[model samples]
Target: MIPTSKPHNPNFSSGPCSKRPGYELTQLDISTLGRSHRSDIGKSALQQAIEQTKSLLKIPADYKVGIVPASDTGAMEMMLWSLLGKKPVDVCYWESFGKGWFSDIKNQLQLSDVNPLTADYGQLPDLTLTNPDHDIVFTWNGTTSGVKVANADWISEQRSGLTICDATSAVFAMPMDWEKLDVTTFSWQKVLGGEGAHGMIILSPAAVERLESYTPPWPLPKIFRLTQNSKLIEGIFTGATINTPSMLCVADYLDALNWITEIGGVDAAIARSENNLAILTNFVNQHEWINFLAERVEQRSNTSVCLRLSLTDKQLKEFGQLLADQQVAYDINSYKDAPSGLRIWCGATVEAANVELLLPWLSWAYESVKNSD
Candidate 1:
C-alpha cells in the first residue's frame, strides 16, 4: 500500500491534469447545487467562461469557440466527422493519439484517399513532405510520447488546406499561433484542472467557411452536427451548448481562467510549465538511471515530460511500483504502446517547489528498488 503522507509535494501525472494554484475541491461554488443549468444565472457564468477563454488565449475576434459534449476525444471526433472528407487529408502520426486519428480516418470514415505520414514514438513526421493542398491533422503535443511540434513555421502561410490541431495538452501551457491553426480542440481537465466531461473547439475563418460550404458524406448525430438549416450554428460558440452541461464544471473552469488571467494569461502559464520542466531536466541530467524519452531537447514537451529508466523492463516496472508505494504519484507509467517510462505533467498549476521536492524522492525510490533487486 502507498504511504498517505509526504511533504505536501506532488509528482506529475499526465491527465486528468494538474489543478490550479492553491486549488481546493471544497472551495468550489457549492451554491450552484439545486440550480438548473439553463437558468439565467448558470448561463451567465458559462458565458463568462467562454469569453474569458477567448481573451486569455488571445483568440482572434473572428474565430468561434464552443463547448462540446465529450472531452478532447469527442471534440476531435466532432471536427473530423464534420469537417473531413471535403478535401484530401494528410494525417500526421507520431504518438498514440495520432495513431487513433489514423484509425478513425481508415476504419471509421473509411476514406480511401487519405495520406498518412507517420514516425516512431519519439520523432515527428516530416512536415516538409506534407502537401499544402491537402487537409492536415496533427497534435500540437503528443501527450503519451512527450514529443511536440515546436511551431507552425513549417505550414505554408498561403496554403488552402485546413490545419487541424488536437491541442488538448498544449493549450494554455504553450503559445499557439492561432492564425496558422484552422481547427483547435482542448479539454477543461487539462491545463485548467477543471473537471472532465466537456471539450472546447475553436474554428478559424477558413474552418467556418468549410462548415458552411461543404457537407460530409457521413450522417452526423444531432450532437455532433454544427450546421443548422444550411447555416453554421454561430450561437453554439457563444456558450449555447448542444445539450445540458455541468454548471459546477463551468464554474470551476471560470475559476481556473480567472486564475490564469491574474497570472498574465497564456504566456505566464507557458513560462510556469517551462520552469517546472527545467526542474525535471536538471534532475535527469545528474541521474544516470533516467533520460528523457524525447530524442531531442527541441522535441521535448514542456507540459508532459516523458522519461525512460535506464534499466530492463522488469526493473523499470519494479522501480515504478516502489515510487507508488512511497505515495509520490499514481499512474506515472507511459502509454503501453510506447517504450516503458514515466510521463510527468508539468502544467501551470503544478507547483515548481513540489516538483523539486519530489525529485530526490524519485532518486531514493530508484536506488531502493535497485538495491532490493
Candidate 2:
C-alpha cells in the first residue's frame, strides 16, 4: 500500500517531483469539480494559469503559450510534426529524450536527410556543428543524464532555421533565453509539481509562420494539429485545450503557479533549486563514496542532479538495493540508457532542508552497504 502519510522526509525522484507550500490533495474546492471544462469557471482558472506562467517566466508579450496535450512529449511532437517539413532537420542528442526524438525523426517521420549529432550521456553535442540553414532540435536540459546547456549564445539570432527546445526540466528552474528559442515545450508535472497530462508550448513569430505556411504530407492527428481553418489557433494558448482536459489537474497547476508567485517568481524559484543543488554538490564533494555523473560543473543540471557511487557494477547494484530498503527515495537509480548512478530532483518544490537530511542518509547507505559487501 502507498504510505498514508506524507514522508516526514524529502522526495528526490526526477519527475512528478515534490509539491509547493500550501499544497493539499484534499484542499481543492470540490464544488467546481463536476463542471464542464468549457464552463466559464474552468476557463477562467486555466487562463489565470497561462497568465501567471507568462508573468512568472517573463515570457515576451508576442509569444503564444498554449495548453497542449501529452505533457512535454505531446507538445514537442506537435511542434515536430507541424513544423519540421518546412526545412532540412538537424537534431542534437546528448541524453535519452534527445535519443527519443532522434528515433521519432528516423523511425516515425522516416526523414531521409535528418542529421543526428549525438554525444555520450553526461556530455553535450558540439553546438558549433549545428547548421543555421536546417531546423535544429535539442533539449535545454538532459533530465536523465543531469547535463544542461548553459547558454544559447551559440544559436544565431538571425538564423533562417527554426530552433526547437525541449525544456521540460529546465523551465522555472533556470533562466531561459527566450529570444534564442523559436519553439519551447514544458510539462506542468516537472518544475511546477503539478499533475501531468498537459503541456505548455510557446511559439515565436517564426514558429507561427512555419505552422501557417507549411503542412506535412503525413496525416495530422487532431491532438497534434495546431492549426484550424488554415489559421493557427491562438486561442489554444489561452486555456483552449485541443481536446478536453482534466479540470482538477488544471486547478492543481494553477495552485502550483500561484505558489511559485507567492515565493517570488522564477528567479527565486531558480535560486531555491540552485541552493538544493549546492547542498548536494557540497555533500558529494565531501563524500569520497559518491561523485556527480556530469563530467563538468558547467554541464551539471540544477533540477535533476545525477550522481554515481564509487563502486563496481555488481557492488553498485547491491548498494542501490540497500538504499531502497531504507525507503529514503524510490527510483533514484539512473535511467537505463544513462550510466549507472542516482538521479535526484532538485526542483523548486524540493526543500533544501530535506535534501540536506538526505545527504547524510546517502552517506549512511553507502557505508552500510560497503560494510555488508
Candidate 3:
C-alpha cells in the first residue's frame, strides 16, 4: 500500500532542484523586472548575488567571485578555453560529467600533455597522480553516480598548477577547503534550488594571476573572455554580466540566498543535507536489494543520493515510473550513463522528515512491482 501522506515537496531532480521550503513566486520581486541588466537597479541586484555567494561560501579573501553565463558549464568552459595549455593537464574522472571534460581536453583543446586519470562509476581515481606542475580539472561531485571527492588533502598547498573544480552539486551541501582549491564553479540550479542559466565562478589570487599573465592559444568567444589587454576585467567580477540575464531568475536566487541565511547558513545547510542522507541511509541499511551507487561510504554524495538495485534496467525504469505515477516521488531515474536504479536529491532544501516519509513509499512501490512481476 502506498503511504497516505506524500513528501511535503516532491521535487528531487538533481538540477534545478526543489526550491527552499516556503518559497513563493511573490517572494522574488526586487523591483528590477524588465529593466536592462546594465542599469543601476539591475547591476545592484547582480552584485548582491556575488556578495551573497561569497558570504555563504566563505571564499578566500583574495578570490574574485563572478556571475557568468550558461550555468556551471559556461563558467567552467570559459576558464578552460581561457586558461589551459600554459602547462600540462591532469584531468580526472569517475562519472559522466568527468567524461565530458575528458572529451573536451582531448578532442576540443587537443592538449599535447593531457593525462587521463579514470575510474569506474561509484569509485574515484587516484588523487596522487595529479602532477603539481600540471593544471588539474575535476568535478568535486559526480551528480550522476552520487560519488564525490572525499576532500582536498591529496592536493599540495605548494603546487604550481591551478586546481579547477566543477562543484555545482556539492557547494553549500558539503564542506569545501578554500585554501586547497584555486578555481571553483557552480550554478544556482543545484543546492540552492534556484533558477538555471547562470553560473558562479570563484577565482583565487593564483587563478586571477593566470588569467592576467597567460592566455590560451584558442580564440575566446565574447562570452568566454575574462581578460583584456593583459588585465582581468574588474567590472565582470562586480556584477557586469557578459550578457542579458533573467531578472526574475536573479530575484529567485536572491530569495534562496536569504533563506540560506535564515536556515543557519552554510554549515546548517550541510547538516540538513547530511541529516537527510542519514535518514535515507538507515532505510537503505534495512533493504537488501537496494544499495548505494558509490561503493565507499566516505565518497557517497549526501546531496545526489544514487542507489543501485538488483532489478534489471527495464525493471528499474518501471519502478521509477511507478513511484512517479503514484505521486510518491519524481525524477528518481538513474542518469543516462549510470547503471539503472534511482537517484534522489537529498540536498539542503530536502527536509529530513520528508525523506522519512518517502521510505515506506519505496517499499510500497518495490513490493507492488515484485508481486506484479
Candidate 4:
C-alpha cells in the first residue's frame, strides 16, 4: 500500500542536507552582495560568523577559528601541510575521507614516519593504538560509513602530540571535547545546511604553537599559509580571510547560525539530530531486514545514518529511485565508495516528523522492489 502522506520537504542530500524549517531565501540579508569582501561590511559579517560560531560551540578564547576555501578538505589540507613533519604521525582511517587523508600523508606528502591504522567500512580503527608521542590524524565522524568516535576518551589528555580531526558532519550535531583536539575542521554545508566553498578550522593553543614553531619543507601556497615569517597570522582568525569569500554564502551561514541561536544553541541542535536518529532506530528495531552500517551503536552517526537493507545491489538502486520518484526522498543513496545501502541525512535541519514520515516510504519502497518480477 502506498503511504498517504509525504515529507513536506525532501531535500536530504548528506552534504548540503536540508535547510532549517521555515528557511526562506527572501529573509536573508543581502546588503553586502556586490561589496568587496575586504570592505568593512563584509569583514564585519565574517567576524560575526566567527564570533557566533565560537560562542555557540563554547570554543576557548585562546583557540582560533578561521574560514578557509574548498570546504572541509581545504582546511584539513592546510593543517596537514603546515603542522605535520615535526614528529611521527598516526593516520587512522575507516571511511573514504579518512582514507583520502591517509593517502595524502603517506603518498602525497611522502612523510617517512607515517603509520596507518585502518579498518574496513562499518568498523572503527583501533584508536587505542594511537601513541601519545605521535601526531594523530582521524575523522571524528565517518560520514560515508555512518560510524563515529563515541567520545574523546581514547585520546590521552597528557599526550604531547596534536590530535587533528575532520569533524565536518559531527560539529553541530555531536558533542566534541575541544581540549582533546588540537586541530578540527568542518564546513558550512554539513549540519548547518549552509552554502559550500567555505570551511571552518578550529585550532587549540597547542596547534598555534606548532604552526609558529615548525615550517614544512614543502612550498606553502598563499591560501594554505597560516604563518608569516614564523608569526601566526592574527587577522585570519579575526575575519581577514586569505581569499575572497562569497558574501551571499556568508549571509546564508549567518542565517543558519542565528537559527542555531534561536533553537537554544548546540545542545538543542544535537538533540534534534539525535531525535531524528531515534525515529529511524525505532523503525529499524521493528524490522528484521534492515540494519545499521555501523557495527556498534555507540559508533553510529546521528547525522549521516547509513543503513544496509536486505536487497540486491540492483534492488538497492531501484529502491532509492522509487523513493526519489515519489518525491519522498532525494540523494538518500549510499556514497559511491561505500557499500550499497541508504544514507539518510538525519541532521538538525531535518525535522523528526519528516523522518517519521520517511520510514513507511522506506518500507513501501523495499516491498515494491522485492515484489517486482
User: Which regions of candidate 1 deviate over 4 angstroms?
Assistant: 1-7, 371-373
How large an RMSD does model 2 have? Answer: 3.1
* Candidate structures ordered by lDDT, highest first: 4, 3, 1, 2
Residue 210's C-alpha lDDT in candidate 3? Answer: 96
User: Which of the numbered candidates is closest to the native, going by highest lDDT?
Assistant: 4
Model 4: runs farther than 4 Å from truth?
none
Worst 10 residues of 2 by lDDT: 1-10
Q: Model 3, range 1-373, lDDT digits (tens) per residue?
A: 5579888877888987988888889777769998989999999999999999998989877899999999999988988888899999999999999889889988999988999899998899999989988899999999998999999999999999999999999999999999989999999999999999999899999999999999788888999998889999999999998888899999999999999999889999999999999998999999998899899999999999999877877777788888888787899898888888899999999888789888988887777676444
Best by TM-score: 4
Give every collision pair in model 3: none
Better of 2 and 3 by TM-score: 3
Q: What is the TM-score of each candidate against the true structure?
A: 0.96, 0.95, 0.98, 0.99
Q: How close to the true structure is residue 97 of candidate 1, measured as C-alpha lDDT?
A: 94
Task: Write one digit per residue (lDDT tens) for candidate 2, span 283-308.
Answer: 88787778888888988999988888
* lDDT, candidates in the order shown: 0.86, 0.85, 0.91, 0.95
Of candidates 4 and 1, the better by lDDT? 4
